[model samples]
Target: MPSDARSTDGSDPLDLSGGERFGVWRAARARRRREREEVRRFTAVSRRRRITWIASVGGVLTLAVACIAAAYTPVMAVREIHVEGARLVSSDLIVRDLDGELGTPLPLVDRSAIKAALVKYPLIQSYSVESRPPSTLVVRIVERRPVGVITDGDAFDLVDVAGVVLTSSPRRPDGYPLITFEGGSGSSGFAAAAAVVRSLPTEVLATVDEVTASTVDDVTLTLADSGAVVAWGSSEDSAAKAVALQTLMAAYPPDAVARYDVSSPESVVVDPR
Candidate 1:
């Protein structure tokens, strides 16, 4: 209104005198807003990290529970039992004995029960059990082989090299040599005879008629076809003895020799009938 006089309309006289002060206030407010925005971003990032960690832990727990539950459910139960490598032993009997495992979970199959049931069969020397997931159990058996037979009055006891009685028959079974030794099954004589029998080749063993031993070093045999006697010294050097006997038998047929002395296989002594 008048020269050098302030207006009454609350204007700053259109002047730049307070511009620097207002600029300071505006910069401070902008800085405060920027700090608040940074804090909010940091909080959001931490929250997302916590949510991710919780989700990962929950997933692991859920998977572990699912696996454990599946192990005990019918999905993992045994539905079939199979027997393999059973020759002298009955496969059906072994399968029947292991029937208790059926319907049981594979992971929970009673191994003690299987062992107890398998021990009933003496012919089974060793066995292994395997599980096929989602339903099958396999049992493999190894049976003892009889090397000779012993006379037990009216019955004949088939025995293996270890002197274990495999079975008994009312009548004399063919194809096995008759064993006779003084000291019941534990004598050195029996051991020597059993070793000699075990060392015999498949072809040579088939022709053995009888085995007799009163002492360890006097194990002897008689041929079935020719009735020729074989003087086997002991279990020592049995492989050589077998080879010598087989060679001598080939050179001089059993029909032509009355006795074959393989006690010293290096120099065989053949006596003519």
Candidate 2:
């Protein structure tokens, strides 16, 4: 009989002995390992690219924030301060108080602080402040106007309609009427006196010299030239009082009319000259 081994032919899956098959398997395994190593290298390169991208974006954001912060920091002098509707107050004084922020960040100006400082000035009635982006500060003010004169000892103080004292003059004012009160204390009587003046006719008010109020019910008016006294008595029926005075004066010219009493809105009494 022939040898039991079969003849190796080209038709066989592989023309190799057992040792050759083992060698081929080892070679295939090595190739697969090399390919896996190449894939791992590609993955590592991709992860490195992603990290670099994130770092670059973070760096840009930080730089932007730093630039913005630096820009807002006060590095320049105050360029402009616009003041509007100012009459009684001096713009220089208001600017002086704001000088505290000369080197401070304008974008970060404290609104409350500025307002508190400005309101301290007695002349300023109401004020508003604003900032121009990156540089300027604007202050707007409404000042008190002198409405009447307040009597204090030998001196007289100019006051606003709100009874706030503004300025004092050595003598009585030429335009406004002098206001007097009882107990020699004339501070609180300013508002009441002003109310009486405002309620009177414009023509009558123009000729007023002094306004005396001893009590709530007694309000006396002294004329400018003749020094005539008109008993006004309280602030009620002011329009009617003005009309009665006009009618009385029409009937009897003011040259001879000494005292005109209009305390009662319905009646008019003309005292003998």
Candidate 3:
């Protein structure tokens, strides 16, 4: 068919195509439309990926800043201190001494400072510290126990097994026996006396009055009421010796005997006063 020439409504004939030319033009237009659609699809995907990346990086940075601020803020700092397990050392004193930790972040409190402050207190044997998040601190204390007292003139110095003096008084305090040794505290006599005194049974210990040691081999205990001297020998075999003394005392009352010798533990003897 020839290119149609026609007039509709008295207009000029419309230009129209058929055959190869028309097919070529139609294919070109479709290709152009597909290319534009591809470009639009690619642009939308790239834009979405960029937005997601920006949001992820911004979120991570925000979290990092928040963590740093919380770590240093006063809201997480120490405001109060509590002391536990304290007996000889006052709990209030411990809390007051640790006041330097106040206003410090809970995670940043100095352990060395705490130890330094507690070192000045002689009664504290050991201690531990804890943080109760947001605003509280806790300190636990262990105190030394007095084993006996050593007398110098009119003063009585209470001492532990290690010979560290805990306190001193002018008058004798009850429930503690007197410790008398030839050498102050450096000698084997003092060590032996301490070991022997600590080894005595509870019942036998209450009846005892004084612990005396001239040498490691000559430790003695004088009964408080009867003045009966117990020859307690060395610290060795002390448990056995204590048992023997109790058995002998049962057989022969301490008040009736002047001295009870149980240094050998297995063999015992008593002399009448």
* Highest lDDT model number: 1
- Residues 8-64 of candidate 2: C-alpha lDDT, one tens digit per residue: 652555468989999999999999999999999999999999999999999999999
> Regarding lDDT, does 2 or 3 come out ahead?
3
**Segments of candidate 3 deviating more than 4 angstroms:** 1-71, 247-253
**lDDT: worst 10-residue window of model 2:** 183-192
Q: How close is candidate 3 to the true structure, as a TM-score?
A: 0.69
TM-score of 1: 0.77
List per-prediction Cα lDDT, in the order shown: 0.91, 0.77, 0.87
- Alpha-carbon shift of residue 164 in model 3 (angstroms): 0.6
Question: For residues 105-158, what per-residue lDDT tens digits would candidate 3 score against the true structure?
Answer: 988999999999999887778889998876889888889877788887899988
Can you give the TM-score per candidate against the true fold?
Answer: 0.77, 0.60, 0.69
Q: Which whole-number lDDT from 0 to 100 does residue 42 have in model 1?
A: 99
lDDT of model 1, residue 265: 88
